[model samples]
Target: MVHPLAPLSEASAIPRVRRLSDRHIAVGERWIFSAGFNVRSDLADTGRVDVELADIARLADAGARVAVVSHQGSYRDGTARHLDFVACHLTALLGRAVRYVPGTVSDAAVRAARALRPGEVALFGNVRLHAGEEANDPRFAARLAMLGDRVAVGGFSKAHRRNASNVGVLRLLPGFAAASLLAEAERLRPWSGRDSGRYSVAVLGGTKPEKTEIGLVHLASTYDLVIPGGAVLNALLAARGHRIGASVLGGGGRRCVATAAEVMARTDRCEIHVPRRVVVAPAGAPYSPRRVVDLDDGVPPGHAVVDFLLSPWARDRLRRLAADGGRALVAGPPGMPTPAGTDSWRALGRYFSAPRVRTLLLGGDTVAELPYEGPASTGGGAALYQLAHGTVPVLDELARSAAHMSDMPA
Candidate 1:
């Protein structure tokens, strides 16, 4: 077996990364990564999966003796498949078999990682398996931090939650917390930078309105165009006094609806576009007859409108906007598109890939629905970013982690 400390002479697999002339792990050097892959079945195609794979590959290429710390799933989703899924990817990305240590980043886990041969990696079990993780207990962070000589955060999806793996361990690292090879964090870096001359657009959707920030009132005031879609559209429609029939409302519902109406009515800076047409299913049936209805037609009491009414008129206006240049933010989906997968996502994919759209972002459930190869964040990060006018605490922590690197006594 190759000695763990022997220098790796191989070049980096990632583009433009400088080669490690001598990628040697001295007595106790290891790259501890806070990875964000969850056990949810969606890991099969989500953006977090895509980005983390690249990060792991890069770290492996850098010849770092790596320890991947990941969430198996949300705290309650204690499914073995989740750990099995993440471990599979870790092994593939590292190009060598990985050892699974079923414990917190406790002393045993640390010892197991340290014992690996050069190029070997250890994937720790769900950090959330331990009680101290979610509570941000210092003892947990300290224990987890002991596993590595350095730390990097690879789980962009989990950044919003200040957990033991992502936030706690960083406090003890000597310098900046290393970033997983992140690309979009920079694109979204200037979230708070404001310019009245700049044009912006935001599209808010999804079934759970509770997940949205009423601060969207601010986005409505700031952007040039605001389109409400999915179930949120039902709220906006109701706020505008349109009949939504039996469509379930989400987020702020009546209150949020009223506020949005007032903004659309009063604000000159932003124009709110509610779909005049929508996709509705009769009686909310899985195979119910679905059709596009005019905004005034309303849903029948037993029926539900599940998708944005993408009429010829609606499609034309949206494509025009995409063809034009500006910043665009997609909040999320209201509920699943009714009648299965026909309505919502195809049009969204077109706009997401449109070249002239300039800045494109998707957050919340919307991120999962459309898996385009681009920078995106989960609903939590997206909501906070919108509320803060683009500032994300996780991203901010990543930014601040650098100061610790440069200013602290090395």
Candidate 2:
């Protein structure tokens, strides 16, 4: 009989191996564990064991050769810090030797791994280079498995994904959850209680409409939904039959609008809010105040809607809704980048800066552009967060949200 938690397809394909050592081994009992930086803002203050230098030391001292895999660029100062900490601590702890794989796992990474002795460890560079990693290819899983005897998945933030590292490899080999990964899973488990004083609100914004649609559908059922940023707002407008520019549409904008419409039709309990007023730039021109359109009027073609107009009515509504204590999630930038003197960008910043809103921000452009002078947080379905967290489950959550909303009574 197959293991209960294992997927039916995987279980049928391969019988579950009883012991860790019984599975397979290319070298002296290797244990491959995946890790990533804790990017969540709230976790920073909670005195968590974030797989720091000491953590690696402890593992090395226990005779486990450590292999660190991260997608972050070496040029980035942050990546340097993580590498420095790992290298310094591992060297100090091992006191003999260490090896580093400088680039992403490919033929090169495989070659490097093959060269390692039974007891030696090899750290592969970023795993994101292979498109199969995101697609959760079995071949990729098999390749990754070649590096270790047993797999210990510790990237909790990424556990929700069925990707190669998070799921595929687990199926192919004996799998164990890393301590930190288990802890994060446990932390989120209590969130099932509706009255846990932990209601979450997500602000969905991104350039990709499909991703935004999926993320919003998921988050909307479990938490309050706040929609911002030009792309998402435009999609909302398009769903309502407003005329967005053909240029934008051909460039992956139409698909977003279509996804939005589909989502709006599917979900009932999740409230989808669009901006009351939108700043639009005429085709091939930077946004100007003269082109701003109220949602009461239809959007014109050959124009891009840039920012949410925080009118008194909208501001009052947001402030009132946010007065109650709960978490707020913000994704994507509030507006498109405009000319330096344009009011679109400035207005977008002001909307985010408004009082009475406690926000947990996610996505790269959203965090970079918006002047959100509050406690910042990061968690989302973007490729950046996927690489950072080492998994992508935002899409799954989005699908679940849509289903939950569909089940709600009208």
Candidate 3:
């Protein structure tokens, strides 16, 4: 099924083409680099080329003039010190000089770009600081376009959006997907086939619903959905007429629920599951045993449900369903303070991490909360399991896989 977020019209499917000669290069040459820079435990093998300081070093060593931009300043001091560490390591790896432009992107950033000769590198401050970046404003797109001669998109994590940097800038330049982008595409190729099944399950819940909504809509037709956690589940429950106390509308919360419902309506087979019981607490109190309430029992005013409470029967049913080797997608944690005692969180951790279960954990929080103590794989423990001896599609590469899948003779 076509992802809801996919462009309605298919653009020319451009196989990633490598520029072989400077003739292919244009004057005012620049390479616009961005990375899905979030604190992810399983990012190394997920096909996203996380822009690190070492990447800066590598670009510098190649003598490839580069300019970097991102939505947010990832590091505390704004120096991106960890990235700098990687850059320092890359310098040692390549025996080359690397330079980073300090401060966020602004008119100064534009001026700095103009000052650089071909082969020099500079990193701009977070792109997210500008509201237009997320809004996909044309003016912002035009401004970013000036930084590059040929834009090379390296950030696959943000590939689902038609935002200014990811898609808008591509329209104006001779652009191509970067090595990381291509690699991500190739990594998730297994899900394109018809045999992948229509009854797919997506485990959805996250601190940021807006980001998750993009991925969910894309995969909706391919999966039957499951939502967990205080925010996502609450929104879903609220949609079904359950009062979830506070609203989940801000910070991409409401958008997620609305998008999920749209996908479910479009694909008739979809179903959303919210917890039958929730652990609630008074507005300002810590989660305590006395505060938990059954949804059927009704919640008191000024109370919030903080976790899911599964009965033995429900746990058994979920376990049985998961154990059948059915396709499942897990995103977001089932509960907050996941390390804190929460039965639903523990149950989900056990169910998804079970060897017999065919589970794909999406989003950052889900992976971090997994109980596994050891380094399992580069794509995180859950991804490695889904990709282990079988194939699981990672979202960063969805576009490429969709292209390949659409090409099969039906």
The ten-residue window of minimal lDDT in model 1 covers: 1-10
Give per-residue lDDT, candidate 3, residue 224: 48
Model 2, 52: alpha-carbon shift in Å? 6.3
Please list the residue runs of candidate 2 whose C-alpha ends up more than 4 Å from where it truly belongs after superposition.
1-29, 36-57, 72-98, 102-111, 114-121, 154-161, 179-201, 246-255, 282-291, 296-301, 337-358, 373-378, 382-410
- By lDDT: ranked, best first: 1, 3, 2
- Writing each residue's lDDT as its tens digit, candidate 2 over 31-123 gives 565655433332322212244334444444455554555433223233322233343334554564656675445677666765655456555
Superposition-based RMSD of candidate 1 using all C-alpha atoms, in angstroms: 7.4
- Tell me each candidate's RMSD, in Å, in order: 7.4, 10.3, 8.7
lDDT, residue 141, model 2: 76
lDDT of 3 by residue, 1-410 (tens): 22222221122132323321212333345566655443323334332333344444444445556776654332223432223433333345445544455444567767777777766766565565566666778888788877755455555455554567765665555454455544443444333222344334455555565433544454444444454565666666666667767524336666766764665566343445556778776655535443567777666677766677766655665666566645555555566552365666677667656565555554345555655442121233223223222222223233443344331111
lDDT of 2 at 148: 60
State the lDDT at 149 in candidate 1.
61
lDDT, candidates in the order shown: 0.59, 0.49, 0.51
Relative to the true structure, candidate 1 reaches a TM of 0.72
Sorting all predicted structures by TM-score, with the top scorer first, yields 1, 3, 2
